[model samples]
Each structure stands twice: as C-alpha cells, then as structure tokens.
Target chain A: MNVFLQELRSQRRSTLIWSLSLAAFGSLYLLLFGAIRNDISAFEDVLKNFPPVAQAALGFVIGTLKTVSGFYAFAFTYIVLCGAIQAANLGVGAIGREIGGSTADFLLTKPRARWSILAQKALAVLVLLVATNVVLLAVTIPVAAAQGPDFDAGLFVLLSATMFFVQVIFASLGLLYGVAAKKVKSVVAVSLPGVFAFYIVGLLGAVVGEDAIRYFTPFKYFDIGYILKNAAYETGFCLVAVAVVVVAVGASFAVFAKKDVQAL
Target chain B: MNVFWRELRANRKSLIWWCVGMVLMIYAGMAKYAAYATSGTSIADLMKQMPASLSAALGFAGLDVMKASGFYGMLYLYLLLMVAIHAALLGANILAKEERDHTSEFLMVKPASRSRIVTAKLAAAFVNVTVLNLVSLGLSFAVVEQYAAGENMTDEILLLMGAMFIVQLVFLFLGSAIAAVGKRPRSAASLATTVMLVTYVVSIVVDINKNLGFLRYLTPFKYFAAAPVLDRMGYEPVFVVLSALIIVASVVVTYLAYDRRDLKL
Candidate 1:
C-alpha cells in the first residue's frame, strides 16, 4: 500500500505532463476540424500532392481525411505514439530505477515480500495510466462532438480507448525488460529504442502491405483505418495483446522474486 | 588531441551498433522500393493509382514519386528522423555521461581546459555523425540506384544526404547546448530529445496544415523538406540562414555554459 502511493506520488509530475500533452493533442486537432472542413477540396488536393509513402509512415488514411472522427483518428496515431513512450517510461522506471539508482538494497531489506512489491508497482502504473486515459477521453470526446459534423460518438470512444490498450501492452513489456536487464544505467535509453523499433515495425508492415507482420508489433494491434471502417479492433490482435501482457507481467514477477538485489 | 581520440575510442562500440542498425533500416526501406519497381507497373502509373488524399488532408503534392529520386526523397524523411535522434542523443550524452557516471571529477582534474574538453568531445561527436551520414549516403546510393533502373539518381541522393548532414549538425549542437545549460545532469538527454521531438511535431503539423507554414522556421525538418529539396528547388535560403544561426548560437551557448558551471561531484 505504501509503495503504491509512494510510486504514484513520485511519478505525479511526469504523469501530469504526459496526461496534459495527450489531452492537448486531442483538443487542439479536433478544434482545427472546423477550419479544415471549410476548405476540404483544397485540403484534399494538398494531401494528394504529398508523398504516399510518407503518408503511410505518418499513419494517414486517405478514405477518411474529410470527417471529424476520421481526422481525430488520424491525429490519434501521434497520441498513441506519445502514450506508448510514457507507458514504457513508467514501466521501465518501475523496477529499473530501484536497481539503477542502487536503492534496491534499502527497498528489498524492508519486510515486504518481493511479489507484493512488484504488485504495488504494477498497480501504481495501472492507476496512473487509467487516469491519463480518463483525462484524454474527457477532453477529446466533447471537443470532437462540438465540431458539428456527424461525429460518430461511439466510434470515437472506441478509437480513443485503444490508447489505454496500447499503453498496457508496452508497460508490461517495459516491466519485463526492467526486471530482466542486469542493470540499467538509463531508463530512457532502453524504453525509447524499444518503442521506436516497434513503431518502425508497424510502419514497415504498412508499407509492404503485409498483414501477417502486424502480429509482431503492438503498434499494429489497433489500426485506426480499420477501426474507422469496422468500428472495432481485430479480435486476434487484441488476444495477442492480452497474451503479451500476461506473459511479460508474469515473467517479471517470476524473475524479480528470485533475483539478488545485492549483486548490482 | 588525446581527449578527442579518447572520446572516439569510448564511443566506438555504440557507433558500430548504430551503423549496423542503419544498414538494416536502409535495406528494409529500399526493399520496399525494389518491390514497387518490379511490380510490373511503370513506377509512374503505380503512383498515379495512389490517391492524392494528402492534398485532401493538407497541401500540394509535386514530386513524381514513381521515380528513384521521388521514392528516395520520401525515404529521406525516415532517414532524417533516425539521424536527428542519433545526433541529439549523442550530443546530450557525450558531456552529461561523465556527470551521470560520476567521472566528472576524474575528467575535470585533467590538464585540459574546460573549453578544450568541450571541443574535443564535440569533435568526437562530429566524427560519429559524419561516419553515420556517410554510411547512409553510401547505402542510399547503392539501394536507390538499384531501383533507379539506370536513371542516374546519384545527384538527387547527394542533395538529400547533404541536407541530412546539415540537419544532423543542427541537432547535435542543439543537444550539446541543452546539456550545457540544464541543471540536472541526468535529465539533459531527455531534454534534448524532447526539444527534438517538439520541433519534429511542429514540422509535421506544418506539413499537414499550410496555414501553419510560418512554423517552418521553428523546426529543422522543414528547413530542407525532402520533396522540395529533391525537386531541384534546393534548401530554402531563409531556412539555410536559420540553421546556420542555430548551429553557431548553440556552440556559443555550450562553451559559455559548460565553462562556468560547477561540476556535480
């Protein structure tokens, strides 16, 4: 209980920054929807002139750039990118900082069991992430509706909710990396590359038109284009995301329980 | 001189990893171009098939993306991203690592002056980015040419790489400037990367919304946009002057800030 609260309190500043940034992107872009809608034909011509490959790389979808939901869904890719970084940072820092900062000795010597410690840390990250998503939803949904087009409220919620789903998957992988690494000198170093590698994987998969490759990268699990059409996520990918969380979080506990903190 | 060589030797392993990573990235990226080139459709027609939604999404598409130059021009955006990140992290970490690793005292106690050390470390970072740039240039030449199908796209690739070098230099100095000015040694790299990301987002937003075209001044990415540079338009003169200003200012800031700060230890 103490560790959970302490973790939340310690991480309050970064959490707030990430939440605000996420919420800001949602509001800022949707507000622009009105201005852009007035000049749709001109905007379409400009988009046509931009490179196709670059468009795919930026997660732009051609079929839906005209609508509010579609535009926000497109902008939501950048949001997901940011949220993944924050999640990865939080997860890696959860246990990695204790070992890296050489504070594991003091923390481990306390009376709590190792599993209990891990549980509290994981729970704190979950709470923080949920709070971020709530803040994002609260800001984005209302602004999106106010754009006055036929806003698909249900679909917008579905698309926005994927932020949490992606965050959970990355956070688990980050935690596992945190526990498995011998000692981490810098949390950003580990998390940033991991996030970018997956991102590029998703981008390349789109470039090659290879749907099978999507399974390898979490970024592909929630396709904004597909969701814009089908109004749902791929069942297979969602299960894969769940499996990843289960395996990674489970492995973190197993390794962390037996690990010797004194060796570092 | 010893400080420069020592910095090079210390950064050797990571540079090798960066090289390997760049090689794979180029290969993977060019592989897409090869697939596009041979798909039995003339590159021009294939591109014609792709809808001009970006015009719908934001502005004008002028490049003939079916050509080797056009495809490579598109690919350069991704390359710019990688190099920008490497330069930013390299610049921030080169100085800040000493403090983070608690070796600032050991280095500061050396016979060299603080400016001399900064120059040496920055020189090493210079070499690192140069090698990475050349590696990209060489591989881009090889792969983009393969798909060039005898069109002689070398000049196009060179122009793009040249622009890429300037972008890398801008970010490297920007990173060093942030590290030198920041109070916390550990947060220097994060701050540098954050600055890099914000500018990148600004560039993207500008690309998507021409109304924000004024923001081109704020980001290095817009200074030499791939499509414009590859189109024989070349780097905009105004952005060229801005890049130069940023580089010179950052160098001055780094020297002035690092010289006066007390060592963390």
Candidate 2:
C-alpha cells in the first residue's frame, strides 16, 4: 500500500494535468449550456426539426436538450473522449516508462511481490481517473444548480458516479493495451482504435435503429441520457462495465507478471 | 538505405492492418448502398427524402446522392482524412524511432554521407505512404466494382481519390522532414500531429462558418475542397502548386537542419 501511495505521489503532475483538462471540458459544456439557458424553446425547435435517424445518430433526443442532464448526454461523447485519452496516456507511459528506462528489474528486486507492484501502479492510475471525474463533478454540480432548481440532482449524481466506473473500464482497457503491446506507441494505436470502434458501433446501432448493436458499445450501457432521465443506469451495462474491468485488469496482471525485464 | 528499409519492413503489420481496416469501411459503405438499392427507390429518390439539415451535416451539397461514386465522395473524404493522418504519423515516427530507440548512433556511423542517410529515410517514408495509398485505392475500386456495379461513376470520384493521395504524400513528407529536424522523436511526433490537427480544425471551421472563410486559405487542408474534388473538376492548380512548394521548402529545411545537428541518443 505504501508503494501504491508512493506511485500516486510520483504521478502527481500528470494527475493534476488530466484532472484540470477534464474539468475544463466539463466547464466548457456547462458554459455553453448556460449560454443557451434563456432560449430553451428555440433549442427545442432545432431538435424537433432533426430527422429521427439523424437525431439518433447524434444522440440529440427531442425534449431533452433543455435539461442539464439532457445537455450532459448531448455533450457526453466529447467529455468521454477527453477522459479516455487521459486514461490511455497514463497506461501507455506508466509501465512502458519503467521498461524504457530500464528500471523495472530494479523495482522488482525490492521487497515487493510482482502483484503488489502491479496492483499499486494500477491503483495510481485508478486514483488519477477518479480524481479527474471528481473534479469534473465538483465543477458541474454547482453550475447545474445555478441553472434552475428543477435540475435532476439525483440523476446528476448517478451520472457522475457512472463516470468513475466508466473511467475504470477505459483505464483498464489502456492498461491491457500497455501489457499486450511491445512498444508504447502501440498503446495509443490500440486505445484509439478500440474507442473509435465502440463509438462507431454505437453510431451504427443508433442509425439503423438496432438496439442489439448498442450492447456492443460501452456508451450504450452508460446511457448518460437514460441515467439523467431515470436516475439510474441500464443494469445490464453496469454489469458489463464491471465485467470488462475484471477481465482486462486480470489479464493485464497475468501478462505483466511474465514479461521479461531489464535493469538499468 | 538499409536502416530505412529495416524500419519500413518492420511496419509491414501496421500497413496490413490499416489496409484491412479501410477495406472494411468500404464494405460497410457498400452495405449502406445495398440497403438503399433493395428498397426499389432509385438512389436519387432515396437521397431526396433525406432531411436538408442532415444532408448539410453529411456534406451532400453539389454531390449526386444517388450514385455509388457520390456516396463514396461523401464518406471517403472523412475516412481518408483520418487514415491519411494515421499513415503520415506512422511514416514520420518510424523514420525517427531508431533515434528514439538509441540505435541511431549505430546506424548513423556508416560510411554514407549524412545527406544520403536522411534522403534514404525520407524516401522510405514516402514509399510507405505511397504503397499504403495504392493498396487502399485498389481495395476501394475492387469493392466498388464487385458490389456496387453498374452505378454512374464520375470524374469527381477520380479527382477525390487523386487529391487525397496527393494530400497523404504532402503530409507524410512534411511530417518526415519535421521529424528529421527535431532533437527528440516524441516531440517530433507531437509537433507533427498538432500541426495536422490544427490545420484540419481550421479547415472545417472555415467551411462551416462563412465568417471564418478568410482563415481557410492559410490551412493546407483547405487547398482541396471536397465538393470540387467530388465534382471531378480536378484540383485547383494553385493549391497543387502551393502543396508542392511547401513540400520542397520543408525538405530543404530538414536537410539544412539535420546536416549541422548532432545526434545525442
């Protein structure tokens, strides 16, 4: 645990940068939301005019754009993209740097089990992700409140909580890529394509009106819009997100444990 | 030359993966076409039913909505923008990775002149992009011929492909030159990526908002309009000339910078 804490301390700068960036994206969305707050009816008119297929493709559901949560769902993809990039950058560098610098073997020689080292590094990444999401929530909540009392606080809280789990799933994806790829550059290749594929699947489903394909995209499970409307997540997607974390993290540990290392 | 060849060969898997990915998108596109074709509605009719706003978002103005070539124009531009960026970055980074790997000293110590070494590396990067583009084009045509047969083809489709191919070459060569001059490979990669991304954003913003039109001319991406290219009017000679000048200037700058610089890694 001390080693895990130490790793977190070592990553303080990266953590701060990611946290600030996530907050910035959240703040940008909120600012835009505020700009349009006075003219909700005009916005509704725009949404109403969209073709159903196009609306679905863009996740611009009718009658939802006026609510804070609705706006959140509308802008969720951009925020998630930013968050996912943060997690991917962390995963690519965290382990690969140790290997690149020839410090992995030296670290392994310490009074630590391989599992402990892996666990601690993973914990550091998780903490960073959580901290970023927390900062995002911290800023977004007050902004939502300032908008109106009718804002669904319960749904807002639930959506924010889901972001934590969402980040973990994506971070684990990055870690898995880190473990499997031989070079750090390959980590970005894996994460970017993987995220894009999921997004594309979600889009395909939305455009084709096929709920079945939605199951393939993590975005569908999170359903920022649904959570905002119902104050809860899709139960099945929550389970899938948890399952993804368990499988990816377990697989990453298994791979990292056996990989060859050289000491500086 | 040997080192360049080595890096190019090492990237074979990546090249193959990229080719397959693009071909798969084309397949998906053909599927979209098939769905429309089977509905007994002519391509023009189906397209006419699409909402004006949606068509605007999808970049359909001045494009034939009913033809295979038109669909290709609408979809291929976005896909190729992304693919070409990937290819350019890959081409640039692989050329500089030897230094990043601390193997540049071994490679650079050969009896060949520094200019020859740099030229070989740049040549290899060019060849990589050229081959990838050719493969993607070949696969796209194959799919168009086999699946979307008897469709009205346009000169615009050819021009679109040609413009994208040239754009890929410019970006790849420009990025390679930037990489060669930079002291750190990671910095080089970041710089190249940032430049390309900023250019794309500028180009898009300019197109979407008429107020930003004046800023468009500054970005290399704005040189070839998707509408014009898809219309098969051929590239504006001015843009082609500008791209060539930029490519030549970048190459010269790289050669000058690298000739005097020392490799530390």
Candidate 3:
C-alpha cells in the first residue's frame, strides 16, 4: 500500500502534464470545429477530392465532415496517437526507470515481495491512466456539448471512451517490453518507434482495406465509423483486446517474479 | 580525434540497428508498391477517390502512383520520419550520454578543451547521419531498379535523399542545442522526441487549415514538404536558408552553453 502511494506520488507530475496536454489538444480541436462549422461544405468539397484509400488512411469519412461530432471524430485520431505514446511512456518507464536509473537494488532490498512491488507499481500506472481519462472526458464532454444541443452525448462518450481501451493495450505491451528487454536504455527510444509502427500498420491496413490487418493494430480496434453508425464497438475486437492485456500483464508478472535483478 | 573515434565505436551498434530498420521499412513499402503496381489502373482509380486536400496533406497530391518515383515520393514521409528521429537521437545522445552515464568526470579531466570535445562529438554524429543516408540511398536505388516499370529515377531519387540529409542536419543541431541548454539533462532523447512530435503535429494542423498557414514556419517538417520536392525536384530557397540559419544558430548555442555550463557530476 505504501509502495502504491509512493509510485503514484512520484508519477503525479507527469500524469498531470500528460492529462493537461491531452485536454488542451482536445479543446483546440473542438475550438477549430466552431471556426469551420459554418463552412463545412467547403471542407467537404476539399475532402471529396481525396482518393478513397487516402481518405481511409487518414481516418476521414466522407459526407460526415459537416457535423461537429464527425469532425471531432476525425481529429480524435491524432489525440489517440498522442494518448498511446503517453500511456506507453508511463507503462515502459514504470518498471524500466528503476532499472535504468540503477535504483532497482534499493527498491528490491525492501522487505516486500517482488510480486507485491510489481502489483503496486502496475496499479499506480493504472490509476494514473484512469485519472488522465477522467480529466480528458471532463474537459471534452462540456466542450463537445457546447458545440450543439443535438450533440449525441452518449455516443460522444462512447467514442472518447475508446482512448482508455487503446491506452491499456499499449500500456500492457509497454510493460511486457519493460520486463522482457535485457535493459531499457531510454523509454522514449522503445516506445516511440513501437507506437508509430502500430500506427503505420493501422494506416496500411486502411489503405489496403484488409480486415485481417485491422486486427493487428490497436488503433483500428475501435473503428470510429462503425461506432458512429452502429453506436457500439465490435465485440470480437474488444474481446481480443482484453485477451492481449491479460496475456501480456500475466506474462510480465511471471517473468519478473523469476528473473534475477541485474546489478548496475 | 580520440573522442571522435570513441563516439563512432560506441554508436556502431545503434547505427547498424537503425540502418537495418530503415532497410526493412523501405523493403516493406516497396513490396506493397509492387502489388499496387502490378494491379493495373484499378488501384489508380481507387486512389483517385481521395480528396485533393487529403492527398496534399499526405504530401503526395499530384503524382502518378504507378511510377517508381511517384511511389517513392509517397513513401518519403515515412522515411523522413525515421531519418529525423535518427538524427535527433544521435545529437541528443552524443553529448548527453557522458553525463547520463556518469562518465563526465573522466572525460572532463582529459587534456582536451570542451570546444574540442564538442567538435569531435559533432563530427562523429555527422558521419553517422551521412553514412545512414548513403545506405538508404543505395538501398532505395537498388529497390527501384529491381521493381521499377520505367526508366531509372536516379535524379529524382538522389534529390529526395539530399533533402532528407538536410532535414537530418537541422534536427541534429536542434537536438544538440536542447542537450546543451539543459541544467540537469535527464532523458534528452525523450525531450528531443517531444519537440519533434509537437512540430510534426503543428505542421499537420497547418496543412489542414488555411487560416493556420503561418504555423508552417514553426516546424522543420513544413520546410521540406514532400510534394514540391517530388514535383519540382527542388526545395524552396527560403526554407533552405532558414534551415541553415537554424543549424548554425543551434551549433553556436551548443558550443557556448556547453563550454560555460557546469557538469552535473
């Protein structure tokens, strides 16, 4: 319990920074919606000329750019990309930082068991991610509601909720990378490329229109277009996402429990 | 001179990994292009459905996707991203590693002046960027020759590679400047990556909205927009000069600060 509080306190500043940054990002995109709302047709005309594959690659849907919700969905793609990086940073750095900073020995010398320490740290990270999402939603929901009275609050909430799911998926993967790698020299070095590779894969899947490839990238798991039209996530993909997190986190605990802590 | 050799030796493993990663990325893109190329006009028709602004935003607005040069032009965005990250990491890590790894005391006690150390480190980083660019150039040419449907696009390919080299130089100095200016440098690589990402987002925003056009001046990514480079086979002279000034300024700042700043160790 003390370990969990310590981890949370230590990560508080970064969590606040990331949450504020993401909120600012969301607000900026929502503000832009006001500027272009009146001239949406002009924006549509611009989008209409884009090739189908290019449009898919960009996560833009035609005929939908006119509405505040649709435009927000389009801008949300960038938000998710940034959000993934933040989560990955937190996840990778959670365990990796102690080892990388040569402080693992100090932590390990404590009376607590390794599993307890890992659990506390992982729980702290989870709490931070949840806090970030709460702040994001609290800020974005009112701003989105201000766009129009007709705004589908429920659907908007649903769409924004997907960010948390995606973050969990990346966070678990980052945890795996943190434990599995021989040594993590720099968190960003590992996380940036890892996130971008998945992002590019998502883009490629869009361009190729391959349903199977969509399964590979977390960014595609939500399918905003389908969510907007159907008002729900694909159950199959959600199940896969859950399975991934469980396997990755379970493996991390097992490996970390048995692995010898390297002396710096 | 010793510092230069040591930096190169230390960086060799990472350099190889980066080179291999680039090769795999290019190979993957080319392999995808081969399928598109062999599919005839159907793929082009599908591409034509993309909006003009979307195409422009992607930096491949008006090119023939079937042509090897055009395809390479499209893939240039990803390549630019990889190279920029490489350059920034190199610049940030070269100087900052001494402090981060707690080895500055040993190096600082050496006979060489701080300026000499900076020059040697910078030289090593420059060499790494140059070598990586060359490898990319060689591999790109090889791929085009093997898969191209028309005449060799040697000039077009070379021009794009040159532009990427300039981009690398710009980011390299910027990274060095960030490291130099830090009071207690921790995670210089992450700081550099944040700068790169913020600028990239700014560039994309500028592309999406005409009202935000002035934001283009803020990001290095905008300075070398791929479409103009692919279509005109040249960069805007203004941006080129601006990039040079940025490089020169960063280099000057790095020297002055690094010389005066106290080592954390």
Second chain alone, TM-score for each candidate? 0.93, 0.87, 0.94
Q: Tens-digit lDDT track for model 1 on B1-265?
A: 9989999998898788777767767777777776666544432543454444344243225566566676677667778887888899899989988887778999999999999999999999999999999998999887777777779877777888899999999999999999999998878877888888888778767766667789888899889988778765477788889999999999999999999987788
- Model 2 — TM-score against the truth? 0.78
Q: What ranking emerges by TM-score with the best candidate at the front?
A: 1, 3, 2
lDDT of 3 by residue, A57-133 (tens): 43344445555677778778888988999999988988888877778899999999988988888898899999999
**Which is the better candidate, 2 or 3, if ranked by DockQ?**
3
Worst 10 residues of 3 chain A by lDDT: A54-63
Cα miss at B257, model 2 (Å)? 2.6
Badly placed stretches (over 4 Å) of model 1 are A35-62, A206-209, A262-264, B34-53, B56-62
Give the backbone clash total of model 3. 12
- Evaluated at residue A195, the lDDT of candidate 1 is 87
Task: Please give the clash total of every predicted structure, in order.
Answer: 15, 1, 12
Tell the DockQ for candidate 3: 0.24
- Cα deviation at B145, candidate 2, in Å, is 5.2
lDDT score, candidate 3, position B82: 83
Give the TM-score (vs. native) of candidate 1. Answer: 0.89
**Which lDDT tens digits does candidate 3 get at residues B1-265?**
9999999999898889788878777776777787767656644654565555544433466676777778887788778888888898789878888887778999999999999999999999999999999999999998877778666788888888998899899999999999998775667888887798788778767766667878888988878776677777888998899999999999999999999978888
